[model samples]
Target: MAVAAFPDPDLDPSRWVPLRYLNFFRLVIAGLFLVAGSELQLGHEAPKVLVAVAFAYIAAVLTLGFPDAARRIGLDRLIMLQVVIDIAVLATIMWASGGYRSGIPVLMMVILAGAGLVAQGRAVLFFASLATVVVLAENSWRFFSGRSSADFLQVGFVCIGFFGIAIVARLLALRAKANESLATLRGVALAKQQAVNERIIRDMQDGVLVLGADGRVRQANPSAALLLGVDSLEGRLLAELDESFSDFRVRCASADGALQRMRASGKLLRCRAVGAGEDGEGGGGEGATLVYLTDFEEILQRMQQMKLAALGRLTASMAHEIRNPLSAVMQAAELLTEEKRADVQVRLVRIINDNARRIERMVRDVLALGRREEALPEALILAPFVASLIEESTLGGAAGRDVFRVEIPARATLGIDRAHLHQILDNLVANARRYCSGKPGSVRVFAVDAGGRTALHVLDDGPGIDAAERLRVFEPFFTTHPKGTGLGLYIARELAEANGATLELADNAPGAHFVLTGRTQP
Candidate 1:
């Protein structure tokens, strides 16, 4: 594995080029010190040898280019060599221009500052010691030779000032280094947090949208695109998807921050909006809105299940009261019909008997609802199970056997309770056969693949159900046929839910098509 790079200003190799440019400034300052002496005619002039050395150092810096070679030589050793060269060059210039007696020794301060910039820890103190020694040696020689009037006491304080510059420069450099490292760490942490948030948003079951204040979609997840039935959502207005979504824009404008439910993709959806407030695109203008959309049908279904549970408890209490009274009424009507009644009286008795039987059937269905429990689903072959269901639904029928066909893979299987599956198919197929008028091939049962799930469709050739009534077709006690108790479809839907499948009227055009979809076990 390769090692990762870290932000380290003190020991960083890239600082080499900058330090080299700083060295160039040192040469320029030295040249000024030399030229100043010559112009003042103080007999303190720079020799040809000192000028040649300064030019040679500059040439060496340019020839090396942008610190590439200096990096290869390693940081500690390279900075040490550069410090020695700076001391040597400055000491020579001082000697040529009049050291100790003149103010030429102050040029050594540049070398001290450069050492602090490039070196780490106490390395600057080391270079400062070297600078102090060179200047002190020059001063002592001048005093001994009677070439200067300044004493050792005054020169010593001037040497101490070099150490002051080194200490203060080192502190500033270290502070800058610490700040850079902190910024790098924060940047890495922010990036990781952003990545995690994106992953979670992509996988959420509910839809999420970031809408600009201009009403255009700035960002959207897959669920949002699917729910709105749009191929692409970016840059599209929310109200363009459907007329009902115009309410979404209105809600956002008011900033009510309340949950609302709307219809989309033929399903009910719960939506909520949150304001971002004038910084979404970082323009400091009005921010975008965050929209969350959840399927209200799921929440409604759960609430419906809870209501059904309460109803089951209530029905259990009144089951006997309802069944017994109806049974007694039927018996009395039968006795009256057998008393040699007239045609009108017999017809009245028949009506009472037929209605009493219908009530009895309804009672039985309600009793079944109370007994429903958690189902234990098992794998069953699709082809054989469907073949058997078609025969059983047609057997002993008053309308006689109607045409039906089965089309499914030989090895295809489904995970469901056999009885529940039978109930679902029986209700759908029986209803389809009735509408087909017992015509051969007019009633069809076929298998279809619905987005990786296995589905069975029961279709008829008769006039289909009206679109207005389709949504409420599975509701209990709702029926268009006078003889229908209306519980068959409701019971079928309950059975489908128990087995973790879905039964819904898929289409009403050409014919009424009901689809029973299940997860594939194989």
Candidate 2:
């Protein structure tokens, strides 16, 4: 079995360019030195100088030309070998040409510059110390061999000058690196803070909308879009998009922190504006304002539900307290009718009958609150059903002859309980007939198939509900007329909702319009 060779740990394969460039410059310099030495030697042969130049060329090729192949064959370790060989070649050239007086010691500065550019601080310092040792050793050797004192002084000054320049350059490079590291750290922290703020904004359940000073919607989260019944709210003005919300105005002062909540359409809307701080300005002035919107749709719904529950409880208590007196009045009227005085008894019976009927209507309205909704029956074709209801109600004198008119498409069908449906229609038609008494009015019932659902509309030409009264018309025991129970519309709405249908007051040309819409089954 053959053993696999391991990679060299000292060499970085990715960083070959700097090393290659350094070696190429080294080879050029060494070639110049070899030519100069040969010219200065005159008739003498400078074999050592020639040998040093050859070795420098070989070192350059080893460092630059074959980094990848050398790495594959475990010759990558020879990079350090190449550096050592270059240093040796410089030393040999110095010794061959007048030792310290050859000006070859100046090459140590090039070596130090290379080390600083390509290697770490400790590595560069080590190379600098090694070059210093070589210079001192060459000087001592020359001195022992009887060289002049002035030559040693010249070499010492040159070495000290090179060392001082190296120290200053290294200090500046280190300071620059420290500043860069701090800036990178600050950038990372700022990115994390922005991410956190985005997460908080997205996770909010309440509809949140951010607007600019020009009243254009800058940002809207998913909940906000859903609440506003829009696909996307960005780049739209609040007043332009929604007819209900308009003329939004608020003042924000950086000097004082205050928030105001505005109420509109029975819903509370909270808004806040934040002004720019002093540092936000280009020249240290205040910055732009950011507006935040918080919708209270859910809050308003809860309040309405609570009010309805309270009213339900009050009506239950009132019904119990009034039933006993109503029963006594009805019984007293029966007793008075049995008396023999015809004229007095006749007047008393009329008064008793009128009051008794009023009490009975009130009791019936209160009892509707306690009535449980029945299950839906099978689907019924709408045209025939609506026709039958019109004929029966008309014949029953609820709406007198020719008082009610109906128009229904023959193909329309609806899933509903026929009994409850009839009851709802009866109440509406009866209420219309009663209100239209002594007035030239007509009741109209119409039906159509709308998007796979059946829509039934009951319109009366008696009186239309005003905008102010429309909202309260559905409340129980809240009637516009003295004889009206006010429970008719409320019960109609409840029955419609129980059958998975919705009853709403629609805008009519002239009169009250009540529309019911629900899915139609085949």
Best by TM-score: 1
How accurate locally is residue 203 in candidate 2, as Cα lDDT from 0 to 100?
A: 76
Per-prediction backbone clash count: 2, 0
Reference-based TM-score of each model: 0.52, 0.41
lDDT of 2 at 71: 67
lDDT tens readout by residue for model 2, 279-314? 333321233344455555565688689869977775
Task: Give candidate 1's TM-score.
Answer: 0.52
In the range 136-215, model 1's lDDT, one tens digit per residue, is 88777777887754677877887888898888888877777788788889989988998998889888888988887777
Question: What is the Å distance of residue 64 in model 2 from its true position?
Answer: 10
Error of 2 at 69 (Å): 22
Among all candidates shown, the one with the greatest lDDT: 1
What's model 2's TM-score?
0.41
